[model samples]
Target: MTNGDDEGAAGARNRTVAVDGETFVYRRFGGTGSETVPPLVLLQHFRGNLDSWDPALLDVLAADREVIAVDLRGVGESTGRVRDNVTDMARDTIAFTAALGLRQIDVLGFSLGGHIAQELALLRPRLVRRLVLAGTAPRGGPDFHNWSDDLFDTSCLDNPTAETFISLFFSGSTDSVKSAWAYLARAGARTGDQDSATTLEVRDAQLQALMEWAIPDSSKLERLAAITQPTLVACGDNDTMMRTSNSNLLADRIPGAQLRIYPDSGHGFLNQYPVAFGEHVRKFLGQ
Candidate 1:
């Protein structure tokens, strides 16, 4: 991932591309790498847009490879209403990539985007050259019980204050809480563009999806074995929302997948530790 300062100066050029009858906003940066290097496709988390990704992180990753981050449908500047579930969103991503005429690209997906990325690889294995799943899970199983409906309802639709988000998403530690809040304030201020109503709707729909979601079971996990691309599964050691064990399960289930655990961080590990996060991803893709 690229650093913030460098990203502001040299990140990919910004543009809007059409996918699945909808226009999506995307940023493309860095094309000076070796000819053999595939372009990198970045996927953002739930309710997040391209801007939600740290510019600095993007800059770092873009230093050696072409990086493209897109706004998923119903989020950011992309057109249409947000989908009600991850499968539909994943389909949208596949359509988005096909529309761009990309063949064999390295992909990094965070949180909700990670789920979608996995679906994309399962649905179209030939297109993904490498895969990274961060702060996410293979399925929305019983693990989501840690998050309360009230908390989910509160955090989803309204642009939550840093304190509120930290309380809900991070482990209840002073340092973690403080850092989470700070990151939230900074990221939210920089990337937060949700209106009250839109935020609320997005939140409600996302929670509804999660509350009703079920992992595709053994059959789906078996399908993951069909993914031939090198895969990395990572999460913060302290992520209360999605435990490190979840990432381990994904790694163990996916044939030849690598697992990385970031210490002293929570769900937003990428933002909390961008340099390390970018390095892990860069190395994975390099392999």
Candidate 2:
């Protein structure tokens, strides 16, 4: 583990923690100022590794809080097979945090990560101080776990072409297009010791989890009431994958949850409006 004031997402060095003999690789950024505040743990979207995160957003959030981003088991530099269910993934996250000796934390999960985040909070309520879910929704919602062919066509492979990513994440607007390119550039800017892409086996496992998560028999929506933590639900108005309406569902189900929808943006709205979204997160956490 590289220590001592490593700066932004790009500057932070990778570290590992052994959880039940499996090594979990993650990065820690901006824990310098105070001990009163808990670290913010970020959960990535479907098929995302650590490098898939937006560096601009990470830097912005790290300004006020320590940020920890990790590759789940079998993804990127982490070891072990990817779990085939969200519950197991949540268990892994709990184990990872336990190994780090963190008693309390803030969670920000996006898309599939959001699903896992909900599971984590439900599975171990006291561990999470605050919750943020972006571009995601409660289980059993219409279109939940339904992936567009284009989306999988782009992300299911080891390496997605630039055009495929743009189509999957961004809207067609001129501003969205410009931001898409910029976000991709920043996400890829880290030069040394890059992580390997998601493997086909891992992707299959994740997809299976998503499919099972979407089953409506025992809806997680009903369980959202159990998640009494202060929550923030956000998404782009035009999010193609996870419909923006699901954001409303999340806010309505989780008591005291707040909602935000960026105008005319898509799945990657946070990247398009990083400064604004960053400020929102800071204010939410500060409260």
Candidate 3:
């Protein structure tokens, strides 16, 4: 695998894989534990590249098993026409894994990435051994489209600044605000080899997919029954984008799936409480 040195303390190598002529950029972190375990693959939030991830969470997760965080096609360093729906994105994810010869893996999908991860597991159940769905909900239901027009407007604005992220991802609580700033500082620590910002075209395409996923559909609810893989569902009590209720719905529908609700946090709760969240994830995946 083509690799680069750990740009920050995350101890991850920036790498890329060619899958069906499309180049998928990913960061590969070699965990300090057993190599026989399946790699934990991360799918990013809407409009977020690898750089948007918290090194705190990645480093903690990487301590026990190999981890790979990727940029979807047409986002950041990946090369391809951006997909318009979750299914297509899931197909691309499968192809990306196939290119790397990864037979079994665990998946952690955040926000829109969680939607794609659900589709991926349903499309190829055996490929995913376990699943982590954070700040997201299953497809379907009118309320599932609870995100307001302004939230979308602000998030998709050209050249989003730290202020935009603070508003979109965190609760208004003082602690949450402090957490957001600290998370941003760590996530932005890699000054060299930073990824390009996602374009308007990519954002529009993702928004289209999200809207479609929100349409009420019984089939989507039915598909939840098919997700027999061990699942962990996490969300903040105040996730305005996806909403906290959606997480409850997922936990209630998916048999044996565990749910975690972090108080006084928003969509970026994982970043808000990385140590606690990471430890919970470690225990879940280790089971």
Candidate 4:
């Protein structure tokens, strides 16, 4: 195991494993509690690392079940060339799960991770015991550009500024924006190491994938019904990038899928309101 300094204040335990010729690092919490509880697998959004997830949120969820958050390929401590699409990342996820010997785990994904989660559930329905998708869409389409110019222009990848990244995550009215900025600043301060090449490659691959990939059509929607696992679809009412309506549509389409909407929240609602998000997730996974 390649060990690094523990981000102690966060209370996250990090571990690295070899999966499909890559070194994938994951942070785990609460898995050691008891054998009766099932483990939860967490998937982060685009360019997100394990540290991107709130440690407090994982701690809360761990009270009832073990929580595992992964840093996807080409991100954080995970190794591999930059992936071109969600499919590659999804494959990496499957490989990681298999390598870790995790069977029938509850799965949760947010934003870009949500997209990959959907693909994973569809591809390997038996591996997932339950599913939760936050601020995610079934298929990327015209909705990708639904955000206001102000919001779109504030994207961190396009212009890497502390303010731009912070604004892209949550609504201006969110009180946690300061904390979000602090987190981003800490993450940014650790940037530009030997892993800089990996970050750039990942960014380029993501851009290329976004430009060329088209979401599978409504035909793929039929597969959601085939998924026997209990599924939850959630989004913030104020989500601008992916409309709440899209989440509703997904919930309505999938058999027995539950939908929840956070009031006055945006795309990054999970991080914006970790306590509420963790509560909802805990209940759903516990069921």
Clashing pairs in 3: none
Model 4 residue pairs with clashes: none
Candidates 1 and 2 compared by lDDT, better number: 2
lDDT of 4 at 178: 62
Report every candidate's CA lDDT.
0.70, 0.85, 0.86, 0.70
Off by over 4 Å in 4: 1-9, 33-36, 140-142, 145-152, 156-159, 174-198, 210-216
Minimal lDDT window, size 10, model 3: 1-10
Error of 3 at 85 (Å): 0.2
Tens-place lDDT per residue, model 4, 29-81, is 56442333456788876666665666556656766566778877778777778
Question: How far is 150's C-alpha from truth in model 3 (Å)?
Answer: 2.3
Candidate 4 weakest ten by summed lDDT: 189-198
Please write out the lDDT profile of model 3 over residues 125-216, one tens digit for every residue. 99999999999988994475746788877877878889998999999899999999999889877765677778888888898888889887
Candidate 3: what lDDT? 0.86
Off by over 4 Å in 3: 1-11, 32-36
TM-score of every prediction relative to native: 0.84, 0.94, 0.94, 0.84
Residue-level lDDT of model 2, residues 232-283, one tens digit each, is: 9999998888788888888999999999999979888888888889889988
